[model samples]
Target: MCGRLALYSDFPSLACSLKLPLIKGELTPRYNVAPGTWISAVRRHDGSGQLSLDTLWWSYRPPWADDKAPQPINATVEKVATSPYFRGAFAHHRCLVPADGWYEWLAVGGRKQPHYLTRRDGEPLWFAGIWTERPDGKPGCAILTEPARGVAKAIHPRMPLILDQQSLEPWLDPELTDRETIRHLVHHLPHHELTHWPVSTRVNKPEEDDPALIEPLEPSAP
Candidate 1:
């Protein structure tokens, strides 16, 4: 469900991938990013029609909703386009979330084993996302998710809706709201490009944010 992720790539590479203009500020590498926090995303501005990189609270509640509304971290693909709570943002406020990879858990010996899933080529992944202005007036987002595919299927039943590099601009284009057209233009990255490995369960703790969390857990000799 993309509940947890990591973004440790340097800004230069991120800028190159998003074709983003210069943005001033330091971006500290975060290896264990959880929901209910500010995270980086790229989207087109409402007035300027320009692409921008900025931080968004990683949870969503439509501006019209009350403080009691649900703040969801992930929106299922099957319903996001039609759900009243998400359609507006899906159509007009789509965004791209640059991430190094995401964490998913698998059941093993009655315990949950965390696994890291990333592109085989080491390039960053751009997650399909949508945002809305919260009741408090802060910008918030929810990563889109679809049924798991390829090797990722072995780890979890679902995974983030990662976009193909070529589809990034189209996904962010506010004008492309037609469901069929969007389905035609936006395609998920090839599932085969993804690889997964067992990683330290230390990631379960939100406070644990370091490179070691992604280091592959060595397999025991059979």
Candidate 2:
């Protein structure tokens, strides 16, 4: 599950890569974005097929749910289309969540060590997501997760459904609502496309938001 993420890329570069228009306001760098925080998402605007970037609360609350209802941060791709809490949005409100990378904790010995995972090429990562309006009429999104594969399996049993540029358009196209087709489109990034390394434990704290958190953890004193 993608509970924490980092987005430090400038708007111009991110926009260019995502095929989005240059954002008007300053895009603040987020090194330790946590669940429930507002995060950027790309989706097709209603009526028009043009893709636009918008901020969506990281946790997802279904429209029928009360304000006090528990919002989930991640939804399994396999069940998203069938789960009563997510099916409606899954068929109609797909989105792309942009991130520089995400953090996953590895259980080593008796302690958990945090690691940062990003593309080998250093390009931005886009996670598949689904959004819906809440009872208060605000938009919220949940990242889709799949069974962990390859290296990610060593850290956790699940990982975000990271998308390649080729899959973005079809995944976000509201017109293609066929459940079978959508299911087929959902896939994890190939192990070769990703790289991960242990990072400073500072990232374990949501308050520690800086580039240093992504730096490799120093060797222990001998």
Candidate 3:
């Protein structure tokens, strides 16, 4: 469900990779980003029609929901267009969540083995997301997820809806509100597009943020 992510790419490199304008500020590298933390997102300005990079809280809370209401971290792709909690944002507030990679856990022989998944080509990955205004005037977003396929299926039944460069424009185009068209863009990448390997269990802790957490675990150590 994309509960954790890592973004270590520098702003300039990310800007070049995503082909979006960079905002003025220090873009800190985060190796263990968790739900509720601010995340890097790319969205089209409603008036300018230009893409801009911004930071948004990683959980989504509908406008009508109370401050105490549960904020969803992931929105199921199949229900995004029909679910009352996410439909409005799905139709009008689509965004791109840039990440170096994401973490998933697999239950293996009574133990949970954490795996780090990233693009095989080493390019930044962009996950599809929807955003909405918070009561306090800030923006919050939730990543869209679909039933897992290929290598991801070995870890869990769901994974973030990672989008390719070609799908970015249509997915974030605010004018294109047709549910079917949006749904059609929700697809899995080729099985070989992503690669995963067991990583240090240190990533299990949100506070433990460092590059070493993503390094592959020694096969004989466990």
Candidate 4:
């Protein structure tokens, strides 16, 4: 599960890189983002085929009658097509959550050591997500997840569903509804394509949002 992440790219740079239309307001860098907060997301509307980069609440709440617990920050792709809570969004509200890197905690000597994972070549990563509007009219999203691979497996059991430029068109295009196509896209990203390094525990605190949180820390795994 991707419980924490960091987005350091300036909005203008990100917009240009992702070919997203310019957003009206400026976006500040977030180095210690946690669940249930506003996050930057790229959404494509089906009818107009237009892309919009906007901020949305990080957790999604379903339309079920019961006032159950807040929806999960991430959803499993296997159950998405059939789950009542996520089927609608899976079909219509697909989105992309962009970030420079994400934080994962590794169990070392019974202590949690934070690690920063990013593309090996240092490119920004786009995580597949589903979004929806609540009764109060606020937008929210849930990241998708799959089993971890390669180096990430040593740290955690699951990783975010990351998509590359080649997959972005298919993932974002509303016309493709077949579950098989979407399923094929959820598998592990190339192991060689990513790199991870230990980072300061400063990231453990949600309020510690800054550039330094991503800086490499020594062999402080314990």
Clashing pairs in 4: none
Off by over 4 Å in 3: 20-25, 185-188, 220-222
Greater TM-score among 2 and 4 belongs to 2
TM-score of each: 0.95, 0.92, 0.93, 0.90
Residue-level lDDT of model 2, residues 1-222, one tens digit each, is: 889999898777678777644333346888999997889888776787677778888889988898678899999987998999999988899998889999999988888899998888988898999999877677999999998877888888988999877787788878788899976775556877888888988887888898888877879711
Better of 2 and 3 by lDDT: 3
RMSD of 4: 2.2
Tell me, by lDDT, which candidate is best. 1
Error of 2 at 8 (Å): 1.1
Cα RMSD to the true fold for all candidates? 1.9, 2.1, 1.7, 2.2
> Candidate 4: which stretches are off by over 4 Å?
19-25, 184-188, 219-222
| Candidate 1 collision pairs | none
- How well is each residue in 1-222 modelled by candidate 4, as lDDT tens digits? 899998888777777666646444447788988997899988876577788788889988865424565678999867877788888888878888989899999887878989999888777788999998864567889999888888888889999988766677667778767788776764445777988989988888898888988888866332
Supply candidate 3's per-residue lDDT for 84.
Answer: 90
Give the Cα lDDT of each candidate: 0.91, 0.84, 0.86, 0.81
Candidate 4 or 1, higher TM-score:
1
As a whole number from 0 to 100, the lDDT of residue 49 in candidate 3 is 75
- Residue-level lDDT of model 3, residues 7-81, one tens digit each, is 998878778876656454457899999998899898876888777788999889987898798788999988999
Which run of 10 residues does model 1 get worst, by summed lDDT? Answer: 18-27
